[model samples]
Target: MNLLEAFKQTKFQLSGHGNRNIKVLKDAFEQMDEQQESDMYGSGKIIEEFQDKLASYLGKESAVFFPSGTMAQQIALRIWCDRKGLKKVAYHPLSHLEIHEEDGLKKIHHIEPVLLADKNSVIELEDIVGMDEDVSCILLELPQREIGGQLPSYETLESISTYCREKGIKLHLDGARLYEITPYYKKTAAEISSLFDSVYVSFYKGIGGIAGAILAGEKDFIEESKSWKRRYGGDLISLYPYIVSADYYFDKRSQNMDEYYEGAKTLARLFNECEGISTLPLEPVSNMFHVHFNHSKEKMEQILIQLYEETGIGLTHYLNKTGEHSCYYEVSVGDRLAAIPIEELRNVFNLLNEEIKK
Candidate 1:
């Protein structure tokens, strides 16, 4: 059988909380009151309360919910640029805005992005200090996801924040997986977020919600975003479903980040013990990391499929080719890892080591 088929058949998976099926949404709504009112076009108690909760949690004066992080972030950059009368912003080259957003920020908003730092490395304070051109805002992704969840030190983050405020440049956070990094940083969400002038967080990444995002900042900044939200066609008649799921899962999983962080370290160590296998970051700074295999993509797939069938422990269902002889996949620890029996997990890794050595 193919890799995905084998992974589907496995009894357990090493990444994510569980299958993201309709059941995920069903479970979130199971405990809700049948008469609970739904949000309408971004108003009503459901949407407003969740936004307030998130804003308070992130230490922002206000917050707004969006249908997607893509929409929220584009609006954020546009607002920053309009305020400064400069259509330019700075961020890592591997930023979602650069690689994944299809230039929406550039096309829809006409904002120019100044790419900073090396593609494979996290942006340092020095990179920001060295920028030649002026920008209205600087966006930083904590535990930079594209680089195997690598992170700049808290001291570096402080230095960058201080520099941005001193230069009148707004600092924005693309904190898609913010909850996953707090354990490593030993700080609360509010503490980390206070450094940024504005922050955007995703509900579906580490939080495992259906789909939604929160944009938080000063009251004025968020108020401006609401207008842009309507202009971007983001104001759906009802966003109660997404908001309900986000709220339920945030409560259920947010406190489990510390457990997930430990689980990630344990899993990474097991992978590193296997021959021809290594992990980015060597040690994970968050509950996510990339696993690299020295074998070609074709060979790794064959090996992983066999492993899954034999052990019924699915490490990953897919791999990405990095080179002719190198392949990789990402892992984010969650409730699923905790469900696997310890003895079975040990045996799976032991067998994985044997197969990789061959």
Candidate 2:
């Protein structure tokens, strides 16, 4: 079973978007504008406002909204490859393009992936220096997920951008969790985005939008992307629900993202003080971090379930297998995390460790 979303009852889930109640959507509609024009093929006041807002926020010439990040990125990269007349794109080995997309970028678009640096490591400026192929674009995930939300230093990012610009290789950011790291890096969305040729931010992940992504880039690039959207069946007749929800959350949750980052740092510190457990990066660079344990998956699962049943503190929904005798789980602090006392959470981790040892 997929452990990511499997839980009987969780007082405070460690990761994922808000499992919003049905009324949340109802409330958004109640507050929505009645005079707004409904988007037809991405041409309505509602869609245009959302797109323009994202474009300004990201410091890009234009922006387009997509039904999903998968569609947004696929088309964005396709446009890059087409303009450059190259079939190859570059990204980390474990990025969504490699693992989750199932080669949709390759199978459908026929764009090859030049797995950069290493399979399980962040791509560095030096990594691109030694590349033998002139690729179309380099896709980067801000605070690279699947690796504990680690972010490269701003200096390194700037250097990489300079190098990419010199080499004429377009840079794309898969900033699904961009807002989460904004506070950590001390940079606004546009400041960080200025380094990339194209940037994609998700509405649902960090922002708690209903479901969608905003792809931003130059006007011409975005114009080309719109055509791909129509071809890929992403240009829905009406996307007001996604638009309004994203607009609402972008204003609501984004304000507290920095608080979430601080909470993650505090949580990581407390966990590391315990024996037989540690957080990857030792310090969280974003709102998410990996809690590594020296125990079997079965043992951890049992303890997680037992603890949730007895204490009503759902520290984690599932543990990810890292090795034969090691596992890791992500802890993402949300508004619910603010309700529970930090001391109580620490106690749960301590007890979990003690139980696992036995």
TM-score of 1: 0.99
| Per-candidate TM-score against the hidden true structure | 0.99, 0.94
| Candidate 2 per-residue lDDT over residues 230-267, each given as its tens digit | 99999999988888888888888888898888888888
**Candidate 1: minimum summed lDDT over ten consecutive residues — where?**
349-358
Candidate 1 regions exceeding 4 Å error are none
The residue ranges of model 2 lying beyond 4 angstroms of the native Cα positions read 1-7, 14-17, 33-36
Total backbone collisions, model 1: 0
lDDT of 1: 0.94
Candidate 1 lDDT over 95-201, as tens digits, reads 99999989999899889899999999999999999999999999999879988999999999999999999999999999999999999999999999999999999
Clashing pairs in 1: none
Give lDDT for model 2: 0.84
Q: Give the range of the ten consecutive residues with the poorest summed lDDT in model 2.
A: 1-10
